[model samples]
Target: MQPHFAVPNLAVPTFAPASDAGLPLHIVTERTLEAWLSQQDAATAGWARTMGFSGAWGQVVVLPGPDGTASGALVGAGSPKSRQRQRFLLAAAAAKLPEGTYALASDLPADLSPEVECFGWLMAQYAFDRYAKNTGAKARLIAPEGVDAARVEVMAAGETFTRTLINTPAEDMGPEQLQQAVESLAEVHGATVTTVVGEDLLAQDFPLIHTVGRASDRAPRLIDMRWGSEGPTLTLVGKGVCFDTGGLNLKPGASMALMKKDMGGSANVLGLAHMIMATGLRLQLRVLIPAVENAVSGPAFRPGDILTSRKGLTVEINNTDAEGRLVLADALALAQEDTPDLLISMATLTGAARVAVGADIAPFFTDREGDAVTLASNAQDAADPVWRLPFHAPYEAMIEPGIADLDNAPSGGLAGAITAALFLRRFAGEARYMHFDVFGWCPSSLPARPKGGVGQGTRALFQALPDMLALS
Candidate 1:
């Protein structure tokens, strides 16, 4: 039987056609509620007050028509101070609205983007119900004027692909399954995929990747996806550690609970790839994913072992749990060989990244100052939210031990996220490189975000690509 993964419906049913007719939705906040109510007739204004609609965040109240049927509704957008701390605030109100298509009648908050709001409105209806059914009257929204309908749909599709891959269990998303995803995506996008699996990895000089995954029955491989024939070269390398059991080091049950999401980097890359190809972005795109499972067996790479990478740098493994970077090291070296204009690696590399920025923010490291500045700004605008962590040249000595050219896990465990980035940088060599240490799972459900695997930096990078490539 073929391995199956759920693909959620992200394009339709959540949005009505772009026709000009939709029920009016009046957006308001606590401070502006009185002024808006003053213009209303006695009955409508009195009914709102009687329903206790004081315009707190996400508060919604429906207005009765002259003949006692539904007319329109009022939604609270909250103050700017409160809006900064949340996402998809209006979508929360949309979820509560009755099953009808609604359109914005009033202007949005000054600081928000109608594009982003529409994207959230569509994403809020997603459900991963592969084995179960999602029951609800899906309240749809009309695509607001001045927003690109196709762009938002592409984002929703990419995001749905990412969330589904990350949420699937390890049994169905191993190296082979992951390759299937790449193949399926390539088939749809007219891209080509090539992979080196099992012992063939050692033949291809991917020793670090093979060592980390040799114990798994499913085998390890490097998935290479190529698309687009013209424009600047952009290579994306994602750490596809399907499951991290910490190898021989062995993670306890608590630490291993969410290991299914360890390949979030690969998921996000594919998501970004989907957006790029579908949106007709001008670029020759290359996606490299080193898919492996750090399993424990007699053949598993040991903590004290030293291995030579594809770049020929020696790595001393102090902890088997640090396998994500090991697999990424070899993949980055392979990507650097092409000398792409910009090389980016994304991985669920270290716990210290989460310690530094929490789960809501994606923390990144890059050697290029221009990329750092542009990415941070674009991420905020895209509502993806990325923070830059330095490459820290002074800490170069931290990752070096007397035994090997690099230490997989430095002693003392301080500045772990930085040291890991520094380690991957060594493999990437002179290629202009960027790295993302992202927490790809949303631990708690909030607004449009369901409690499951999520895409961290994909959208921001999508928005910044044209600028990064100097496209006209």
Candidate 2:
């Protein structure tokens, strides 16, 4: 197993100790780029003209000192006043600069938050080379004075772990592979891991999980990993359908292209688990993942069948394509058995959430006001946006199926995200449960963020967990 690093609260480094100490930096917005450089002193102005630097993302120009040494540098932010803050530009610039520590010499505007700097550093360090070639540029940003180095490393690890898992194709990442990933973390953090596969799931009373994944060539499994001996117990359950062929009800060509990222929820929970264990946060952690592949075959569970869940609740399958919730139901029920201080389940369960919030934002559902605020605040702080939708009781009526205890999916299209939450809520019961319906893929590239399997909610949840534990 690879070595794991902790997220510590170390003493901040002082700028006086920087290798490039006293070096000046000029920040230029797009509108003033040419004019500002033209007005600079002879040596500084000469470099700008030679470089033909326009204030684009990751643009950099350096001026020479009297001894032909480096004098100052000009880094561009496309537009500082624009509402959209391009976070990765500065860090990307920092990474490409010569090997010397540098500070943000320009004055930051009053409205800019510390997150810009924090996320900038994070984006600069980002790389996912698990399976693909990644002989990429090295990250060399000087840790800003007073920055929390430990926390940033922890968050980056979480995000990287998530992206690595999601980005890998399903062929290389099945139920067993998912368990292996969990085991890797367990070994790193000295946690305990247990998994039940195929017939073993039936023995364990995870009938719904068993039924849903039986058709797959690779056997389905449930991964349960534990960490932290004492403190408030916190459980995380994530739906881990490694690949979803939509069973009998198959998805269209465009839709199935990214089915490999179906286990995004499992990736997310593991990422959050990484953060908690790395920080050595005060909480007893337990993670349950119902890992499987919903493939079509003669033995696959049909749409009209009634499936028995770990909680003993019967669910009638309204659609075979809605298999994510089926697996989550079993995992959530298992989580509730412990009745931990807090229960959070995350899944890329419904396309309705995507339709409602779009690709950039993830919508979450929770019962408590304090939990919502903390999650929202942490999400904002992390720059990983998560929106909260009501666990509105009235919508529960929509999931009520005539034939069974509940329906996998309701007949009507209205409130699809909410209805799915209500379905998962049935397994949660009175537990302090919060569910994140995340769109695990980035639709297109934006600034530092690229288009591919994107890991959404864990960063904010990682930051929020400690406070939530304290309140509990």
Candidate 1 vs. true structure, TM-score? 0.96
Question: Whose TM-score is greatest here?
Answer: 1
| Local distance difference test values of all predictions, in order | 0.88, 0.78
Q: Tens-digit lDDT track for model 2 on 177-239?
A: 888889977888999999999999999898988999999989999999999888999999988
The residue pairs in collision within model 1 are: none
All candidates: TM-score: 0.96, 0.88
Give me the runs in candidate 1 sitting further than 4 Å from their true place: 1-14, 66-69, 135-137
Candidate 1, residue 461: the lDDT equals 97
Residue 468 CA displacement from its true place in model 2, Å:
2.1
lDDT for position 230 in model 1? 91
Model 1: ten consecutive residues of lowest lDDT: 1-10
